[model samples]
Target: MAVIRVIYKEYIPSENLNSIVDTIWIATNYGKEIESRILPDGYVDIVFDLDKQKHLNSGNEIRISGMMTKFKKVISRKNSETLGIRFKTGQFNAISNIPLSKIKNTTINASDLFFKLNNSFLDELVEKKHHWEKVQIINKFLLAEINWSDLTPNKLEHSVCQSIQLNYRELDLNKIAKNHYISLRQLERRFKATIGVTMKEYHSIIRFNKVKDCIAKNPNLSLLNTAFDNGYFDHAHLSKEIKKMSGVNPSEL
Candidate 1:
């Protein structure tokens, strides 16, 4: 078998688009085919498979990848290039009002969701030969596609998401709902509609990311200590959750 190498890089969007877009990324696969595991990060992505011959049956190069609940595997075909636009959590609604719940844990053609991102625009994006060229085109396209005047996130849901970030280690759903003057059920319903995941699921993602960061930064930290410090019941609980979310144990992570 020939050696396989993949080049992956991420570019920050222009300052004006920072609120809605997380980063624009690209990947190029060379030689042999490779399989990559995508871990859930609670964000949505618009992917463009630049390989014309392997484009979807509909002949559209663009596809929408929804929020992932668990790890999923993707094949990077040899000698293929792909570009991805990752949207910030809860910010995807600015471009298209489609409810995230409709596409959660699934991948769908871009045309199925919104008509604004038409074929010509996608073709222009795909035709770019260099990474920087593609980035510039996408930045300009998103600026035209998103309407700032009418973009408004639900205040309650936004606050809840912010609170989750601030209190990631110890998320109290009941208290959060009470503070926001809504019932737990109502808060969860609104969060699912807006964020495409339950509050608890999002919280788990936040906590897992924190633990992963802590372990990465403090390599000497013991799993038992990390778990307690991050509010996990114990080492066993931490390992189970990590394995479930990332398909790896804490040590492997």
Candidate 2:
């Protein structure tokens, strides 16, 4: 098999920015174009195509990708450099008034959301020689946008989101609603508004990620054991879920 030559890196934010920003990441491929699958993780991102020769489908170098609800395939252009800022779940609302529901499973030009930044901003990023320099510029720009925005995370909605993420394996929606003193319907509505996916869908994404990680770390482990350990009913159930989310069976995953 031929090896794929790609340079990918991620920079996690400091404690002060951790709650809002998940990480800044970059990927480059200088050879033939490559393809990769992106699984949903219920987060929003701002992606910049650093190669002036290429652009997003919108014909812009900068774009905002909304919360993903399913798997999608993306291509890395030949001699491409792409950088993105992934926002934490439900936190992109703090930066822009654009509703998460409006952009679900879609990519739009960044200018539509970041009206505060000038059109020359993309060019400024391209002019930076080092990736770290580009990251610093983005960090400063986002901090300014966050400080000027008055919107705050919804209290109860944020709490429920946290609960689902932390206890994805044993999620009990009714119990969560009762503990938060809200009806199940109300909880579902709020979660959909904040996260751009249903509570169950987000839970599936979190659980699927955990399952994928478990398999990666312990490839020798049996499917039955993995299923039971991760709270799935059985091997068949786990296989079904993995297939549904990733378009591949557990063994293939």
Candidate 3:
């Protein structure tokens, strides 16, 4: 099978930088073991598992569509390949326009929705459309299906997370707080409580995930070059963050 085209971007809320979400789009090919730990903010992932396995915590074997809103940690050891569309934050609602909290700890069959929306898109990709066009189509589909109502605006943190997804690269948390007329400390507290990780840790993970995508696409690429290109200060700093979260160095991977 051809390598899948995976598009990933890190977003910082223009108004609230501390509370941002990362959006990832995977097309065509199945994914590899994505070792991710739970952050302060929860996420809802939509995946299609081709190989059947029992639940990690609950030893039950079943094929189902599901949403995980709260998790301590997520580690995929083996046989965990799938087509994953994930939203990592309580600020973002389910891809099916549903509230994540409402569906937490439950599994629903999302095959219909998954196939309905993604099938045609993949077919078009097979037809050899430009990469930009593929991205545009995916964005259009996401915009149409995303239910904004599922998100309740309780605090500035929500605004920040939304802004990050809207503006992928250019994010400044302090500026976002000033814009919202709040102190930096206030923003930090909200982010930690709601998102589960400090602002720095969250941003580091976001940046690292972007680098991971690049490495996955071109395994032959140099790690030093990848770090520099993805906004890390240097290769050592990049290695530190990668090992911290992934338990493996970039070179080891």
Candidate 4:
């Protein structure tokens, strides 16, 4: 069986998060046994099944095998096959850069979106050539067809979230604001308004995500080394932030 591959991690900027939602991808070549217990955080997901059964906790454990697609708001599960994107809070704002207040909570058929992409889009991916080009094609197609205007708040939030995700680790907001010729306060306010979270909270999420990547890359890495490598002040501070966000000690994970 092929080992699960974590392609990449991104931090969505406040502007993009307001306009576009964040995405997570786990790809496998030969298929592998993958499971994880995800915590609740108010984001929704639309999952696409490849070959394995995708399960979720919604009353009874919902198992989807074969080619399938579905959507859900929240799930409470200790463990299950992990295949999907975890939309963060305020991430829905980017689903189509529309106002959140105007968007009535509704169900969207996942197959409608997935199938719209040419069968070649999926077929070509199986060969792993020019994958990014194909993804751009899919994204453009979806953006053009989705009703983005109806969710203004989410759209704006999505934009900001995507921007943060893209540049957070390398660029600080203060520098970003100075480069953009805006005051730090102005940037913060704009981010908060669009993303429904403070700049600090967003940064914390980015940092935590970075830590996860570091650990995955080097399982034997020391916590202090990992913390310093990722720009944290020290191990204690990193541990505190991780606990606050994930409700688990770093050592335990």
lDDT: which candidate is best?
1
Provide the global lDDT of candidate 4 against the true structure.
0.49
**TM per prediction:** 0.90, 0.90, 0.45, 0.47
Clashing pairs in 2: none
Model 1, span 1-253: residue lDDT tens: 5888888999999888998899999998877778888988879999888765575455657889888877888888778888999998988898888888888888888977667566776678777888899999889888988888998867788789889988987889999999999999988888998898899889988888889899999989888999999999999999999999899888887
Model 4 C-alpha lDDT per residue in residues 16-85, reported as the tens digit of each score: 3324445544333333344433432334444433322322212112111111111123332222222344
Preferred candidate (lDDT higher): 2 or 4: 2
lDDT of 3 by residue, 1-253 (tens): 4333323333222232123224533333234444454432235544433223423233222222233222335555343333344554644433443443344445555544454443344445334445444445445555555565674544566676665544434457777778788898998777665554555555655666677778889888777888777777788977887776566778654
After superposing candidate 1 on the true structure, give the runs of residues whose Cα lies further than 4 Å from its correct spot: 1-3, 56-60, 116-119
The C-alpha stretches of model 2 lying farther than 4 A from their native spots are: 1-3, 13-16, 56-58, 116-119, 147-151
Minimum summed lDDT over a 10-residue window in model 3 is located at 59-68
Q: List the residue pairs that clash in candidate 1.
A: none
Judge candidate 1 against the unseen true structure and give its global Cα lDDT, from 0 to 1: 0.86
lDDT of 2 by residue, 107-192 (tens): 88887768644447877887888988888888888877885447576788788888987888788999999999999998898888
- Which sequence of candidate numbers ranks them by TM-score, best first? 1, 2, 4, 3
Better of 2 and 3 by lDDT: 2
